[model samples]
Target chain A: MEITELRTPCLILDEKKFRDHCNWMKDKCKRLGVNLRPHLKTGKSREVALCQMISQEGPATVSTLLEAENFFSWGVRDLIYAVGISPSKFSRAAELIKKGCRLKVILDNVETAKALSNFCEKSHIEIPVLIEIDCDGHRSGVKPVSPDLIGIASALTDGAKLVGVLTHAGDSYGCVGSKACRKAAENERDSIVLAANRLKEAGFNIEIISVGSTPTATFAENWAGCTEVRCGVYCIGDLVMAGVGVYKLEDLALSLLVEVIGHQKEKGWVITDGGWMALSRDRGTASQAVDYGYGAVCDVNGKILDNLYVKLANQEHGVIVNRTGEAISPEDFPVGTKLRILPNHACAMAAQHHSYHVVNDGKVIAEWPRFCGW
Target chain B: MEITELRTPCLILDEKKFRDHCNWMKDKCKRLGVNLRPHLKTGKSREVALCQMISQEGPATVSTLLEAENFFSWGVRDLIYAVGISPSKFSRAAELIKKGCRLKVILDNVETAKALSNFCEKSHIEIPVLIEIDCDGHRSGVKPVSPDLIGIASALTDGAKLVGVLTHAGDSYGCVGSKACRKAAENERDSIVLAANRLKEAGFNIEIISVGSTPTATFAENWAGCTEVRCGVYCIGDLVMAGVGVYKLEDLALSLLVEVIGHQKEKGWVITDGGWMALSRDRGTASQAVDYGYGAVCDVNGKILDNLYVKLANQEHGVIVNRTGEAISPEDFPVGTKLRILPNHACAMAAQHHSYHVVNDGKVIAEWPRFCGW
Candidate 1:
């Protein structure tokens, strides 16, 4: 079926571009001499994961346990639940571990590590955990050089096994060019490796050292001590990645398929049925060098419409207007005309839909299912 | 089960508060002497609809075809697909109508009216349509006084029935105080009534003159020429509604229940598992009198925490900080501590979850399922 026949405000994934992106990340990992633990938090589809993972049964990272559970059910066993572990989630993690899934959890504080140890000891199950190092002070994680690093690792005494350290250069998203991204990558690598070395010196056998972010992974010239690079969003590049200079605009593989519904000629607005519900309320590109209001506009064939952007979005209505304050002709895009919208953040956009219309050369080849929630 | 036992980053709906909100809206509409067609777009749950609607068979408004389909299957006969109808969605709308649904579609232009007429003529089915009018030049809809109103009305000849005129005070969201909302409400009523009068003067029978928005509906003193007022969101008050002065802070019925995962004590950050994925990226109150970053922070008991807000959000991590720049003690909210986050926009936050844990008297009584997608 053609994409035009599908319902409006639905996700459209370019199969060829998606495969190319996967191959690029795989090749990049090979060149860097690091394992690519493709983060399933972005694509969140088994079909995409089939092409992303090096092996169908191993090496993946997920933000939520639901992703870990779903991927593990699909035979991807070597998974890392990348977010900080809370006690409420321990039972679910333990269940997955007991089911023979090699699921690893991450934590930053001693309190959580002690709690996990107690829970694991009581449940009679052993779980591997990675001490999260705060490389950029971006979000969660312990400071790389702080004493709490060893404190957290030492607290994992009974059923919790200390593996190594993980750090993400989340601040790399703020970097605009390759130079800044490269610096962020080096800082991320140094931070994690320093923490791992400290743990090793303290008599803890550290094996794994993970570090990554889309921008940092793309521009990192050195991956000396890092064993694996955990990066998502690069598999389906978005406007945020494009603005950060990690991926070009044409490399974005996701777009929202919508049809022209009405026009406000005097205001140069061409409205569509795709609103925040479809594109998401993420304004990742609002503070970037180029602000694509909600999303950048493109034709159904994926050709960029030079100056058009979705300026204002309602719940179910997107008002497309010229960025340069030029008038948009209603005759050019009449009602029923199909248009594709490139999202600002791929993960946020993909999270809004349950399935993707896998399009290749102007035809939808298959429907790849995706799930959400914790 | 207690809400504390439920998973983190899940929705919690206050049953008593929700019922109270429903009753308040019902009483307000009764006093105004207008029909209250509760827009099902906000509370997209059967259980919640049981309280909002006047009967099982609804006079409800939906933002998407999926909502219309789901509500119709639940024995709702009278429904309106409130967004502008696109050609790709016509078949789905027709199927619902053919299944004995009194579904109405709204549109603004002559081209779509002609397309609907042609489609209906070919399929030999009758469908009613409302002419969408531009009340405040906010988003979609044609100008209320435009000559194209008669042209579009005339084009709805074949199998399409001209029902009446409809206008939503979407701009009313920009109004802050009750006085501003009252003026916006008056303007919304005048705009739709004027359009209905124009269509009637053209010798066309106009039956439904509908006008509403949460703010406008809450403050509308005169429902003079309107037959029905369609309002959602107010049923589950949010920070946006509170900021608009339509609903007080204590009236918000929906919140995201999340558990404390870790912290950055030096930075006064208390990180949780509920991020943009749960709370949503709708910073609807950012431009209001007081900005609640991502959401207003509250305890699990739904008590508002003084000066605390979710200042920053990642995909699966929410970094909360004090608005007054005061230091936060990690000992106060240790690991496994649960907190409830009041959302910025009820519609956007509610769309992030699949179900709402109905909390009454500190216990989770039932699980009410909600859905998303177009």
Candidate 2:
């Protein structure tokens, strides 16, 4: 099937760009001498996961249990359920572990740790767990020097083992330039390494030290104490990555294939079938230096259209307008004209669709399915 | 099953509220003497569609062909593919028409109208088409007064038939107060009625005159010269609707059931399993009179937690903080405590999940499946 023949408002994965990005990240990890546990949270496709994996041996970080199950079914044995485990999901995690999937769950609170321990004891399972260390006060995770870290570690008494410390410098995404990103990366590395050292001094076996975020993984010059890096969005770079100078515009591997259905010429707008439902409602780049409203408009061949951006979007209709306030003629972009849209955040945009029409050299090479629900 | 037993970060549909909202819209349409062709674009569920239908006979408006097909399978014979029709979907639309589905496609451009006409001529099936009228300069649609309106209508030849004019006052969503919403509704009613009159004068039989929007349909006291009012979102009220004064907080039918995962005590933040992936990245209420950061925090029983809002969100983590910077003790809302969140936009949030866990009087009554994809 050809690219144009596929339905409009569907996700298009640029195969060549995707492979290039994966290879680039692999090379970066190799140079840094850290195991690259690519987060499957971005693509959530078994095929994409295979491309991201260091080898078929299978070790990956998944944001949700559904993703963990998906990758495990695809023969990914070593998986990390990256989100903090609540009591409700303990049995589900135990079920996956019982199925011979070496799953590792993470948490920062003593209550959840004790709950996991209790669940493990009842289920007769020894589940490996990681303590989430907060590097930049971004989202989840405990402070590197928090006294409760030991309490959380001690609470893992029955069948729950303290595997290591994990930290995600999500605040690295907010860093504007290379200097700031590098600083955030250093902070990320130091905090996790500090937590690891503290655990070691306390006589706990801190086997793994994991830290990452696409921005930090790409910009961090040093990964001395970290044994593995977890990055997801780097495989499908977006405007947010570009905005933070982690990846260039040409590095973005995902774009929404849409068609111009109509035009509001008076407003210099050309309406397309892709809207928030297609492009996603992620305005990640809104606070960045360059705000691509909805998404940056690109031609069918993946060439960025100058000054044209998806200015506004309804459920299934996107209004593309020229940033220069120049009127766009309806004759110029007639109805049925196919176009590509580079999204603001690849992860969020990709989540909107079930599968991607993989395109290489303007032709549909394959279709890769992705899992969605919690 | 109980509400607390269901997984975290999942959609919750309040059955009683949903039935009430649907009944209210039904009565409103009855008072206006217009058919209520509830747009299924919001709650894309067969059961919800059945409840929203004026009669079991079923006539609705869908934003995508996938929705039309889904509803068609559920015995919804009449469906209007409301978004502007492009050529690529012509075959799919025709396939549905051939299956005894009275599917009406809409378009605002002459090019697409010609393409539809060409496709119908070749397919040997007369497809009903509606010319989209721009009620407000918000999104897609041709201006009602433009000569291109008749041109687009005239392009329908061979197997394509011009049914009437359809317009959605999407800008009414931006209106803060009832006065502005009523004015927008007036514009929506006038523009579509004007287009219908023009088409009639040009020797065309205008059968169905359609105009609507949630805000407009809720506030519009007048619906003269319109055969049917197409409105969605009102069926599943949200923070965006509440922000516009269309629905009160209690009227919202959909809420996200999430678990408290962790906390940032210094910042007085309580992190939960719900994030943008669950609540949606919509921020539709950001520009409204009251900005709900991500979503409004609610108790498990559906009571609003005053001043507590989702201040930050990651892919699987939402941080709830007090608006007045008051500290919340971790013990007060411990880990594993389930809570509900009212989304900013129901349509966007609903699209993130696969199904809604129906709750009534604090119990899981049913699980309603929702289809997503295009």
Candidate 3:
């Protein structure tokens, strides 16, 4: 069935663009002499991950046991549990390792590592693991110079072999342009490399040194010590990337195809059936220079109004507040007018919908399904 | 299992409180001498709808076709597609009507009505509809005094029967308390009644008079001209109700239970696994007197700290900013401390998750599955 006929408030993903994005990342890795083990936390799709596998050659970074299991089931042999493995997930990690899955869990604390060690020893599950080093204090990971890092490594090393160190400088998302992004990426690489050397000086053989973020991975000039780079948003750029000047509006591969359900002519609101349901509540662009309140509003022909943005949104209702002209209330665009909305964050917005109607040249050729939850 | 034991970043619904809330609204309808047909848009779950169904005979109000179809499949006979119906959804409405689904659709334009009429006539489908009257300058609905109303109704009432006139005072959400809310409710009722009277003068018998919104629904003192009332949010009341002083914090039936996965003790930031994913992107409480950035940050024991709130959120990361503390950081909470977050809007937050862990006495007795999409 044609996409236009399928109804509004639907997810659309382009296969050609998705593959091109994957190839672009792969080419960058080949030039840098590093492995491109893209993260699955961005697009939790087996098909998308398959592209990453084709490009990377081996394991990919995962945030959940579900993702690890899904990718493993798809025949991706090596797995890197990117996030800090909690006590609850230790058993599941052991189970996957016991089942012959080549899983390398991440650790950042002595407490978590001690628990993991106990579980592995009891379950007889030998697993290779990496220490998550904090590069820029974005979310989780131990500080590069923290004394607790060595303590945790020693604790977890009883049953799990320390493969190397990993770091994700998520704060690089705040960089204004490619130059700033490259600087941030360099800092990210240096943070991990320096930490690896410190551990190496302490008589530790660190093989894998990883650091990644879409902006950093795409713009980083030098990769002195990085072995693997983990980036995801490059596969499906969003408004956040556009705000950071990393990617243009045209480069964004995903959008919610919505209909002009109603309009508020008095306030310049173009209401659409696509609410937080189709487009997730992730306002990643909020902290950016241009806060696309929710997202960029476009016309039926996918033409974004230069003076208009969705200022406010309700459940299944979007208020497109125009910066110019008389306020066009919900009356302006009567009904059944199609529109394409550029999302704040491609990952979260895409996660809201079940499947993406892969579109290219105004035609939806296939539908790719996405899975949710841990 | 206790909610605290379940994984962090989970939705917990209080069943007993939900039942009580339903009964309270039902009793209010009995006192007002109006049929209480609730708007199920707030509690999108059929489980919550079935709980509310205990009050009215069966059937309910829905914002989307998916909800209507779900309720219908659950043996609900009379259903109102409360949201505006565009030409695109005409076929879906016609099919439901043809299958003996007594569904009433709402429309605001002659252009749309003409299209719907043509489709219904060609398909031999006698669809029942309600002329949507705008009680206030809020969201969707045609103005009661709009000249286009009569013309659109006359054109569309060919194969379709206009059994009612519906108007919702969504502006009631802005009102302070019962007095303001009551006035808004009266305005909502009066606007629809006036439209119905106008239609009656034009020889159109308007049988059903619908008016709703949680605030207005609760304080609607006079529904003399209305036959049925539609109110949704009161069942699973949210922070909006607390802001309007309609309900206390303890009265709220839904909350997101998250765990402290990562913390910044120096910065007073407590990062959880539930960023926009589990808690939703709806900052409904952002506008309230006490702006809970995402939701009111409560301790493990469910006690809300007026001094602390989730000030900033990223994908799977919530920064707990303590307003009164020297440095507000949730990292102060132990790595495994579980916390409860009361969402700003129950409707939007509830839609983000797949299912609800039905809780009673702080223990999860059963799990209710939640369906999404149209």
| Chain B TM-score, all predictions listed | 0.99, 0.99, 0.95
The residue ranges of model 3 lying beyond 4 angstroms of the native Cα positions read A55-58, A265-268, A299-305, A326-334, B55-57, B299-301, B326-332
Tens-digit lDDT string for candidate 3 (A54-125): 433366888777888887777777888886666666777787777778889887777667777777777777
Model 1 chain A poorest 10 in a row by lDDT: A2-11
RMSD of each: 0.8, 1.2, 2.5
**lDDT tens string, model 3, B86-199?**
778888877777777889998776767787888778877788889888898887777888787788779874677788889888788888878999899889988998899888
| Model 2 agreement with the true structure over B291-342: per-residue lDDT tens digits | 8899998988899989888988999999998888898889889999989999
Ranking by DockQ: 1, 2, 3
Alpha-carbon shift of residue A164 in model 3 (angstroms): 2.3
Best by lDDT: 1
Residue-level lDDT for A124 in candidate 1: 91
> What would the per-residue lDDT of candidate 1 be over residues A1-374, giving only the tens digit for each residue?
98888888899999999999889989999988999998999988899889889999869999999999999999998999999999989999999999999999999999999999999899999999999999998998998889888898889988899987899999999999999999999999999999999999999989899998999988998999989999999889999999999888888899999899999989888999889989999999999999998999999999999989999999889989998999899999999999999999999999999999999999999999999988
User: Can you tell me the DockQ of model 3?
Assistant: 0.48
- lDDT by residue for model 1 (B89-194), tens: 8889999999999999999999999999999999999999999999999898988889999999999988899998899999999998899999999999888888
- Pick by lDDT: 1 or 3, better one: 1
* Top model number, DockQ: 1
